[model samples]
Target: MLPASASQLLNPTDVGREFLRLLPIALFVIVFGIAFGLASVQAGLTDWQAILMSVTVFAGASQFATLELWGQHVSLLPLVAVVFAINARHILMGAALYPMLRELPAGRRYGILFLLTDANWAVASQDYQNGRQNLSVILGGGLVLWLAWVAGTVFGVTFGGLVANPEQYGLDMVLGCFLLSMVLGGKRSPRVLLIWTVAGLSAVAAYWWLPPHTHVIVGALAGGVLGYCWKERRHGG
Candidate 1:
């Protein structure tokens, strides 16, 4: 039998509320998306192509990274490798959520995974750790973010140069600040702190020594291994 949390239905009201809650962050997403659209155009993609990529891929960093590699004669293998390496963290993220996700119907499960991004995933995973089951944030917040990205792309392609310097507004730091806040909000035990320290050091080491875009996965795996080896003591164990 499925756990009670697994069978929990997503409330429409909760979804809408979460969407509104994330609206502020979505505005920042718009600015970054605009930048991406402008860059894509400069990289030789048509407006439609830029918008299509935003709609289909929905991954800002990877999209931007691809822009660096854009040329008349694109190398297919290199492109695929870069995309996979950059977004490989999604594999671990999905695996971390699989226990809860397995409770939903297969279609719903995969549908939710499609919407998973850093922000919504942070909220969902943090809430899950806090004993809350809130997949609505993943779905609703993701919808808002997706729409913001697509709309921003359209605006940039149609009226170019509107946002000349997104960095001036500190737009790039928004998501990082938000994710840090989520991590700080979680219950911090000595064990968890140690795990985080190991992850942080591992990431720094990988950033200096490993291939490009491998630090995140390396840090995550390091933390996972430590957690596995040193399980938290239960209340009565």
Candidate 2:
């Protein structure tokens, strides 16, 4: 059972608001999706196949990475390993949200988790750290982002050359900026700062020395362990 304060109740109005709040980010995601669509086509995937992958897989980075391995006959075991290694950080992200997720019915909980992505997870986790329960962002923001991605893929497939250079427009930085804003909005205590410093240093070290696709999970687990060992004292405690 979660602590009383950790229990998150879903509200329809809040969900709607979060959907609107994330609209700008969704627009940027469309650009990324367009890039992926074009890349997939160049990688020997048909238009339909690319769009279907976008709709079904819905993981842009992993999808792009898989494109590099696409061929007449891809090795199943290697593909699965690559995808798992790339997405292993999701395990830590889901675990971090488990307390709030446990409050919901299992079906609803898993349903919402299906929509979990980097942007909405950043928002929800930051809000939670700031003493707010905002699972609405996961559902609502995720829906908009998913739709934008699919729609952009369709556009790219149909037109095929609308966006030649998404990077030139700085579209790639949109999510990074959004996440930075979320982190900056949070309470900046010494404990939080220390945890962030440790996490950042660990991520850098892992990037330099560890195998590919392991940095995110390594840094996340390092920070999680630090937080567990040095629990914050509640106000007036």
Candidate 3:
């Protein structure tokens, strides 16, 4: 039998409420997006190209990584590798949502994955942990965040020089800080702490020894594997 949390239907009203709840955070995302726009232009991407990239590929970290690789003679292999490695965390995030997602039809299930991002996923996961079914946040919150990102890119393209260096104002750390806040808000057990520790050390090791841009995925996978094992052991599965 499915879990009670998994049986809850997607609520449109809840989705709208989630959208409003996430608006404040989306404001910060806009600022971060502006930084990306400026960096994209500095990397020689045309304004349209930058805007389009932001629209299609809403993954900020990977987009920034690509800026370093952008040039007249861009190599395909390294570009693909870095983007895939950095964005691979979505794989785990999507997997984590499967319990809830499976309740929906296959089309709606996969469709929601397109809107998956760190912020919305964090909200949804936290709700699930508390035995709440709140998939609406994934849809509504993701929409707002995606729109904010695109809007920010447009602003940056138009006024790329306004914030010449976003880092000076610490805009670069916005997303990181936000994610950290979300993590701290969640339940923190001994097992969770150990899993995070393993993930962090694995990330550091990968950053030093593995290829560039691989640390993020390596850390995520390490944490995920540990978490999965703990779950299995707890259930005696």
What C-alpha RMSD separates each model from the true structure? 1.6, 2.4, 2.3
Model 1 C-alpha lDDT per residue in residues 67-134, reported as the tens digit of each score? 98888799999899999999999999889888778778888889878888998889889998998878
| TM-score-best of 1 and 3 | 1
How displaced is residue 97 in candidate 1, in Å? Answer: 1.1
lDDT, model 3, position 38:
90
Candidate maximizing TM-score = 1
In terms of lDDT, model 3 sits at 0.86
Candidate-wise lDDT, in order: 0.89, 0.86, 0.86
Q: TM-scores of the models, in the given order?
A: 0.95, 0.93, 0.90
List where candidate 2 sits over 4 angstroms from the true fold: 1-8, 233-237
The digit string of per-residue lDDT tens for model 2 on 1-104 reads 34543234677787889999899999998888888888889899999999999998888888988898999999888788888988887788888888788878
Least accurate stretch of 10 residues (summed lDDT) in model 1?
1-10
lDDT tens digits by residue: candidate 3, 60-102: 8899998999988999998998889889889888888888888
Better of 1 and 2 by TM-score: 1
